[model samples]
Target: MIKTRFTEMLGIKHPIMLAGMNWITTPKLVASVCNAGGLGIFASAAYSPEETRKHIREIRKLTNKPFGINQILIGPGAKENIDVAIEEKVPIINYSLGKPWFIDQVHAYGGKVMGTIAIARHAVRAAQLGCDMLAVTGHEAAAHGDVATSMVLIPLVASQVKIPLIAAGGFYDGRGLAAALVLGADAISMGTRFILTQESLVHDNFKQLCLMATEQDTLYSDVFDGMPGRALKSPGAEAMMKKGFSLLQSVKSALEVKRMLNLPLWKFIGLSWSMLKSKEGKGLLIQARSATGAISHLKAINEGDEKEGFLFAGQSVGGIHDIPTCKEVVERIVDEAEKRLKAVGKNVSA
Candidate 1:
């Protein structure tokens, strides 16, 4: 059996984690992964405080095994969602997009906080902030990614931090997990591969696109969320690339997010101000100015309107082809990793 700091720390059987992709990592998917011995993380960025509670309760009902919640630190309802997780005393709390402000609070309740970073410097900072663990994302990641690939970033950050690290980007199978361990990561986190699973609620059209996609089928641009990100090749994405930024469209999207959150106007403004002050927001000030990307993402993932919606995808889509259940996926990955590891050991002994 595969053993690593991630598995030991989380008390799970395998060192695999499901990426918390908004609109994709539903309660059903999370429970399935937990039941299958892998960690499943629920994406709380798109959920209201009440919705987050409901999802957490649903997962509890489905499985007594451990699970986690992922929250975007810069989202409008980030604090609210975090409160829900803390109140629920979740086993794990995963966060990205901004520095965690309530790390002390989370730790006070015996909850672990994992910070997701794309670059080496951020990994060091996260470790310094007492992050229990880190998920280092490479450039081949679907949505927001850094310039370095997993091959380069994982070891680079691992060398600097003693905390357990999880590698992301362009990882789809057991071979990838084995390779990540070799590069100093304790586990691997995947988003694209999980999206194609039978339990994922993503429309079939989106799944088909990922199945048929090639490495060259994805393009990177700053058009989606006002920051650099990767997405599958589609007419809508292409059009956005060509059209450049539109002030009117951006404003419209921001309004749409406000309505979807159902937040009071003053509350919305306060959230916007908090985001603006964050290091991530300050670095990408223009991108943080509007919420158009949120609208596009909802449309694409939910409506499957490829012509007008934005679908954030990772390059790992190129490696996935089957629609297996979550249990099948986890078991297959662990089995393959064992096979590959044993083969390597035999070769070295011989």
Candidate 2:
């Protein structure tokens, strides 16, 4: 029953949100979260525009509750995906990696745009761009994250932005949600926590490893995709780190990703060229590093290749001990947060 600006704005009963994890957060999982009175976001970055539309419709079929779509603004077909979301009038459009070009278009349809940022300064810029909300990611997050931990970055961005903030990275339970609220976030977004859930499509081996992990079991490195990202320690990930790069693997993975997204060869080449010309895409080294992680992820998540594959995880891996249903996860978080808040109220009064 906890209500914040985020919950009210989205008309949801709780402030918990499932991070739009590529390949992991499917329509079934999204619908489960939405039906459980929390926000469920589908990762649209890995799919083609037609696939994105189909998933969106699938989510609609599963639940009448509000949901969202997350698109990586720097990747191939990013523009096409954005257009698909706009045309479908998706309730919430979440963008990461770059500035959104269609904020006004989203607003025109009464939709909200949420910008995900890891750096404190980016929050200010995203707010300036008319983002309705912000998902501030901390270094403790799985996958790609900035160096600032949630403790410092959440409040830092909160001070500078007027929009409601959704704190991400290292959040796992009700205690984390309560802590995020205290840190000035209106809500919290979790990726790894949701990945270990029953609804998640990740392989059982991956889930078991996370349950067995401690904070030290994860490493943050650029080996996976040449950019700094946090992933579980594995032979494959370790190899990437030692070698300092993965040229052949990256090429193969890039082709796989291209095929998965149904991106034509010309479009793929054009996308690569465009990225190379952009400020973020300056060097070929960055490109090489960035290209290797996707297929490894697919190997681990879809094929159960734990030894030669990468599993992006958060530092919260230390705190998670079991695989629960989405409903259980959300309910436990809400109940714990309520109790903690009440206890704090009493302590303050005393």
Candidate 3:
């Protein structure tokens, strides 16, 4: 078996991780990955605080192994959801977008915090902020990757920080895992690959679409969710890119979001105001776009609506050919990584 700082840190058998895709990483999927000896991260961005707590409890019932929750710090209910996780003494908490204000709280309770960043400078800051590890995303990732690809970003961040790094984007197989290790990453996180797994809750229609996608089948733009991110090329994605900002659509989606979270009208408005004053100054436009994108994502995952819904997918979709169970994927990746590493070692002479 392959081992690294990530595996040792998380006490998992393999140096692989589920990428915590929103609406995709449910309790079942997360527990499956944990049971398969890999780190499974439940995405809590789509759920309310109560739902988050319920899901965490469900995961514990499914697997006694280590698992984590991924939260987007900039989203509404982020603090509440994180608070719920900490109250439950979760083993690990992973976050993306905005700074983690509860790192100390998590560490105080013997929990680790993982910060995800797509830029090298952010990696240093995250480590300085006491993040236990970093998930370094590359431009090839499905969502929110900056300009740097894994080839350039992983080693750059590795050279700048002492903590373990989980390389994400453009990684889908054992060859990718071995390559990440050589690139100075302790592990590799796979989003698109996991979405295609047998245990994934993604609709089979979208899975088939992903399987048929090529390396160039993804589109990256700020239109999808008011942030530069990649998504599978689909009619919905194309329409969003062309439609630009729609005040009416955004407002409707915003209301839908408020309903989904079951936030009091005053509380929802307060959250929006807080976001406006946040360090990033996201304001309501971004929030509205995000709400619309979230709905579209659900349509693709739950209803298989290809015309009006789209799924975030990485370039790695090109390399995935089968929908194996979580266990099969983990074992295959580790075994392949072992063979590739040994073969590469033999090719080198001192």
| Top of the candidates by lDDT | 3
Candidate 3: list runs displaced more than 4 Å: none
lDDT of 1 by residue, 63-146 (tens): 998899999887588889999999999989999977788789878988889999998998999999999999899999988888
Pairs that collide in candidate 2 are 225-289, 225-290, 226-289
Looking at model 3, the pairs that clash are none
Residue-level lDDT tens digits of model 3 in 1-350: 88799999888999999988888999999999999999999999889999999999999999999999999988688999999999999999999888899999998988999999998999999999999999999999998899999999999999999999999999988899999999999999999999999899999989999999999899999887888999999888888888887878887998999999988999989989988887764788889988888888889899989888889999998899999999999999999999999999999998
Q: Of the pair 1 and 3, which is ahead by lDDT?
A: 3
lDDT of 2 by residue, 53-128 (tens): 9999999999999899998887688899999989989999999887789999999999999999999888999999
lDDT for each candidate structure = 0.87, 0.89, 0.92
Per candidate, the number of residue pairs that clash is 2, 3, 0
Against the true structure, what is each candidate's TM-score?
A: 0.96, 0.97, 0.98
Off by over 4 Å in 2: 283-288
Model 2 TM-score? 0.97
